[model samples]
Structures are given as C-alpha cells and as structure tokens.
Target: MNNVKGKLIIIGGAVDKGSFTEVSFDQNVANNLNFFETGIMKRIISESKHGEQSRLEIITTASVIPREVGPEYIKAFAYLNAHNVGVLYIEKREQAHDPEVLERLRNADVVMFTGGDQLRLTSILGGTEFHDILLDKFKNEDFIYAGTSAGAAAASNNMIYQGSSSEALLKGEVKITSGLGLIQDVIIDTHFVQRGRIGRLFQTVVGNPRTIGIGLGEDTGLLITGNGRMEAIGSGLVIIVDGRQIKDTNLTQVELGKPISINNLVVHVMSMYDTYDLHTHQMEIRNSQYSIPLMAEQDSDDADPKVSADDRE
Candidate 1:
C-alpha cells in the first residue's frame, strides 16, 4: 500500500476565536461566527468532502479540561454550519476500546484532536482498537485526520513529548517517545515559533539524522498528502528541519547531560502558499514567480528568514 491516499491536517494551537473586546456585536452571533477565517481549523473543515453534512468526531482526551475543550470545538464548527459534531470522551485506555466509541469513529467523516498533553493522548489511545481503526480508515478511506498543538505532535512516530528551550540541544534534555504513529519518518513539534521550540527540533533531527522534523507555528499548519507533498497554510511559518546532509556530529562523544553539536544541517522556513516535496527535498513558492533561496539560519532566537551566510558566520 505504497500509494495509500488520505488527508492529514496538522495544526498549531491558539487559533483566534475572535476578539472579545469588539463592541456592537451580539455575544451569541460573535460566538458562532467565523472568527479565524485564515486559521488551520477552518481549513480542516473545508478539506472534508462532506461539507455541511460532515460527521465530525472531536477527541479531547489530551486536554486537562476535556469538558470545556470539546464544547469550544463544537461551537467553532457549529459556526461553520457543521451540525453533526460529536465528542469521543475517551479519558482512559479502557474507554478507548469502547464499542460505542469505535462505532462513532467508524461513522465519522472527520476525526479531530484538540490540544493538551501529547503524552497523555498517545498513552490513552495508543495500541487500542480505536487507534487501529482510525489508522485503517486514514489509509483506505477518504477520511480526514486533523489536530492542533499536542494533537498535531501526536501524529508522528517519534514525538517530542517534553523539552524546554533553555536546555533543548543538550544531550538527554530533549525527551522523545512513541506517538500515535499516524505519520512516519518524522518528528513533530507544535506551537513551535510561539514556544521557541526550534532548538529542541534541531536536536531531534540531529539525533535521528534520517528522520525529518516539522516545527509548526501557532495558527499555521501543513496539509500533507500520503505521497509526502506538504502544502503550508495559515499566517505563521512552518519550519522544516532536514538532517540528511548534516556532518561532523559530536553527539556520540558528549556525555548524556552535555551539549550536542552538529554541522551543515539544512533548514527551510515556509509560510502560506509554500509547497514542499518531502520525497525529493524540494520547495516551491506558489505566490512568487521567480525562484528564491529557501535556506534559513539555525538560530532559534531569530525566526526571520536570513538572506546572507555572513549573518550567521
């Protein structure tokens, strides 16, 4: 099944729910309006083929406030005229195996994961019958799997569950563990730019040189196809970390708690209307007519695209 086709909408969290301070508007109308028109949440809903008739299942197991999280998504989608939204409240492992939950998943047109704790998400849902069924539908059916923040990070095989920017590149500082494994050969870090996660992402790719790393900025996302073609969406950047050309690594020589170093790593900073081919490691700017250099500096502090090599030198 090399050519299995499905849609994956992985999003960064904190999508705008509208400005609460805006005057002269009814609270009910404002709550049910399309507040974040350019955000990943709207895109996910649009990508689903069923439109108004789409059967959406929101999984809020990852969130600490599951009760509040599900309703937020419901209200947002309700504004989009999607009346058939349901919540799968699978808090524990046994709940993941519920026959009713499995039935809801099977009948749903789109499955969405809300932001919370990545580790909690995978821990509860991993290896369950529901997880298996979800994967099966994703591969064989015309299903759309969408997630934000922790939900987005959980889609990868190797998930960066815990890590702080202060000690990101240090050996043993970055924590990685098995995720939902919806996607392979890559690691995902969400709320990337907002949380300053580039250091950890760089560390992840350097350690697993063959694997790619995706750092998604808040409100930004990638609509990735099964063939490894990624289309960037939303207002913020999508940082792609490629370690295939890395050299002169000192990770092995360093002690477990020491700093790690590597050379010649390739990084790409992408925004809306950018298309990248993971298979070929190529990028194309859809909005621009002429080709421009796609390389970015390795500094996590400055997220702006760098033009000169001397800037880093």
Candidate 2:
C-alpha cells in the first residue's frame, strides 16, 4: 500500500502480545515465544497503569495458529498493561477470514503485528476483509499500529521477510514480496545489522531508486509521525537507505543465483530521537519524538525482564 496515515512500530521480533494491554479476556489460542524487550516495553508498561485507553493493538498472523505467539509477547504486554491498555490476538488467519478480528483491530487504538514471517503476514491477511479494515483504520487518527521482524517488514511497500539474517545479498536471496500496505515509500527489512540485511536493502533501492529502503535492527523500531517524519526508538538503530542520489551502474545484468555487485548506496542510521523526513529525505536530530519521548522519560519501575528477554543471544 502507498501512503496511508497511520503509525508503524517495527520490532526486532517476538513482542509479548497479551500482557501488554490492561484489558482482560479468556485465552482462546496460543503461540510460541521468542525475542526480547526493546525499550518500548518499558514505555507501554508505564502507560497501562493509568487505565486510560492507549492507542495500540497487536496482530500476529505471521506466527498465527499452531505457531501462535500471544503467550510469547509478555514484555510487550507488561509495557501496555503498565498503561492500562488492551491487547488481543488473532490465530487461524492462514485460511480463514473472521470479521471480528477486523472489528477488534478497528476498535483498538494501536494495532501491532507480531514477528514470524513476512510472507505469512501478507499471504494470510492481504486483500482479506480484515486487511481492508486495517487499511481503512489507518485513515483514522485514533489508531496507531506496530509490528516486528516480519511484522515490521510487512508494513512497508515491499517486504523481505524470509531467509536467514545473513548480511550477504546473494543472488536469489533477497526475496521481495507485498506487505500490509501501510508504508509504501520504502522496502522494509528487520534484524538489520545483526542479520547483515543492509546489502539486500541496498540492492532493492538501487533497482528502484525511486523507492527508499528501511532496515530496522532487532529490538529497534522507527516512530513515524502522521506527517511522514520519523524518529528512532528502542536500543538499536534503524537504517535508512536512500538510492535517489546514486548514479548507479550495472545491476540489470545481475542474475539470480550469482551474487550481484553494487555501487555506492547512501545509507543513514536513525537512533533515539533522530528525525527523518520521508518525503524530503532530510535527516535531523530531534530533542524527542513529538509525542512519546523514547527512553528519556522512562519512569522505569523495577521489574524483572522477561525469561527469554535476551533473544538476541
């Protein structure tokens, strides 16, 4: 999807989906657990305490059904619950379309997509009634949605969700596919630096210089404003590749199965409070995110980190 006005919170992977919100519900499904708490967890935890409905929700179609991930996203819940927010899970979206899922998504203030596989996220939800609902929901300011790993990748115009996080952009390795239609100005990649995904993200932008590429590190996310400007949130960095300035050579001849050579590709790093203009391609240093101050105002209550919190290990 091109540009729709909504928020995108991209994570490294494995954000706790259930406990983050303050709402209560009977468990109807389950999924595996993995990944850690990027600093965003702390923010959500503090917010849920006031019992004021915060804007955010999570969708884990990427890890849906037997691979359910609701139980796995506790840190995310701890953060959301701290704010008295609500979190919901949706499984069985693989071959089924449930309208209630969309209803819940529309009702929630923030919508989150958990990590797993970008293909799964898109293949299951794209074009479905629920997917349309998400698209439609973006038109409303009350909604702010986030995703991680595959989820983060799926929020872009194009997604590279499959494959191990190997840095080398080998031929036939950078598999690209359609995403949730949230942010279409760029192609999104996750587990960025750790996974060595820059080469692939760079390659995509080179092919289509008109398109920008964003590589978000594990536990790292980009806080994009409604105006299309952005800030880096979390402990890690979000990489932005700008191919617009490049006067490139020879990539059309690059064939599959054989590694391709890439020339100079402009890359930028976005860390906490960094501002990036999606349209003007301008990068700035901001005092804080216009809305939420990342890590700066963390009231930081003493709480044990999740059991698998160090997923990067």
Candidate 3:
C-alpha cells in the first residue's frame, strides 16, 4: 500500500442523471437544477481541496462518445460552480500521449473520469507519459481522483470488463482485465445492487482470494483515505467481498461451464456512512446508533443463479 496523502471518490453511474430542463415539469426550470445534482458529485466537489478555485480536468477518454460525454460533465460541473473545469477528450492512444494534455493533467487540482468503457481507458492511457504523471500526482499530492461507472471500474488493478449478472457465478464467466493500476489488489464494479452484480463480485474474490471486491451502488461512492480504510458515502450500498478465509471449495474440481461451489465466502453489505477497514477485513460502524449486523456467508447452493464462462478472452 502506498503512503500517499491523496484521496479517491469512486462513484457509481447514472448518479443524478436528470433529463432536460424543458422536459421536466416538476418545478420552475431554473429551480429544477437540483435534479441534475447528485450526492456523489457534490461530495467529489467538496473533496477537491481548493473549493471554488479547483481546476478539474474531466477525462472522457473511456467514453465511446467522448465528444458528447465531455460536454455533459463540463456542464454538470459548471452547475456546481466549478468554472475552471476542462475536458481531456482523448479518443485515440496518440492523443493520450499529447504533451499539452499531460501538462493540463499535471496542473489540474482534480482529474475526473467519465463513464464509458473501462477497457478503452486502460488501453489508451496504459503506458503513456500521461498515465505516469497521473499516478505520481495521485501518490505525492493531495489530489483527488473521481470517476463514475466505467470510470470508477478503471480505478483499480483488476477491472471487470464485460459480464452480465445472470452469468456471473460460474467460473470464468466474469471477465477481468488489467486496469489503470491506480488502486492495487482490488476489483471494482459499478451499478452494483441496481444491476444485481453481487454474484460477479463474489466470483472475483473467489478467484483471487487476496484481492478485495468492492460493489458500488448507483449514487453511491467510497472514499478511500490512505490505503486500506474506506468510508462509504452517498445514498446507496457498498458490498465488500472478502475471500481471504475460505475453508472449502468445489470451484477447482468443476469443469468449465459448470456451477462453482464454495463453502465460506465472507460478504459484507454496507450502506452510506459505513466505514470498512480493508487491512483488518472488518466493518466499523462510525455511528454507534446502528447495530452491527452479522456478516453474510455464501455457499454453492444459495438459491440464487449458479454460474458460466466468459466468452471474451
């Protein structure tokens, strides 16, 4: 774990995805801006350290429609009073290596990634000078890295590329690839509960017992300070899959395309305001008013859908 002082705001997607103002008929068009506001985005702005003076660089490199996605974030952040925001609309690998783009990234107070394809993000920015600087600033400065959906998914070393919830539990069904290497030894999945991704997350930890699996619900965010401690933020849940203490498993014996069986895979379902100690693998209730619920245990035949194989190599 790096002893860096920077912070990360990994947010789920579709967070406060509001429709056009003229289409929304609830209130005055001007007053309807709240619909576009999201708890996670607001939290990111607050964590920017420089407040109004913050220069945020929106990287839309992951989005297939980088032009469209870039403007959306610029507009959204503008509503939050972030007047100095700029977009890094890099579509190809060569653009990611641009000197001007790298300089902008270095001078920016915060660099945010927009939702799209996580694989595209790593492929384009992987070994470039831009990526090196991003990693350096994240470790040495008080910088904050924020992303939504695919953006959030690309923050870790192990990234879930493509796999549906229905086919998740089966061995090899969940496809994972190398990410941006921002956060190490952890797999992050977005649109968690809303998309029924628990099974996929469970399988990820089972395959790599030492790595942690974080499922960030829509409108939810996990604030990681230092290295292994994370505090839940926003309105949704954060599911933590800890596979370090497995006692038995049929995953190895099962043939390809067969359902996987595991005896004791530890799972923790946490909500907003909950704090988890990644190093200790324990959930710490920051607020004493709430009771600590028993940790969940999963087996092969848990009544949920079983498992499959990943077609994408």
TM-score of 1: 0.86
| Candidate 2 segments exceeding 4 Å error | 1-5, 14-38, 42-52, 64-68, 72-89, 93-96, 163-167, 286-313
- lDDT tens digits, residue span 152-258, model 2: 77887677755544634656666677887777668887767765768877667777888888887755677765678877877677888998888755667776655
Model 1: lDDT equals 0.81
- TM-score, cand. 3: 0.85
Q: Best candidate per lDDT, number?
A: 1
Off by over 4 Å in 3: 15-38, 288-313
The order by descending lDDT is 1, 3, 2
Q: Which window of ten consecutive residues has the lowest lDDT sum in model 1?
A: 17-26
Better of 1 and 3 by lDDT: 1
The candidate with the higher lDDT, 1 or 2, is: 1
User: How many backbone clashes does every candidate have?
Assistant: 0, 31, 3
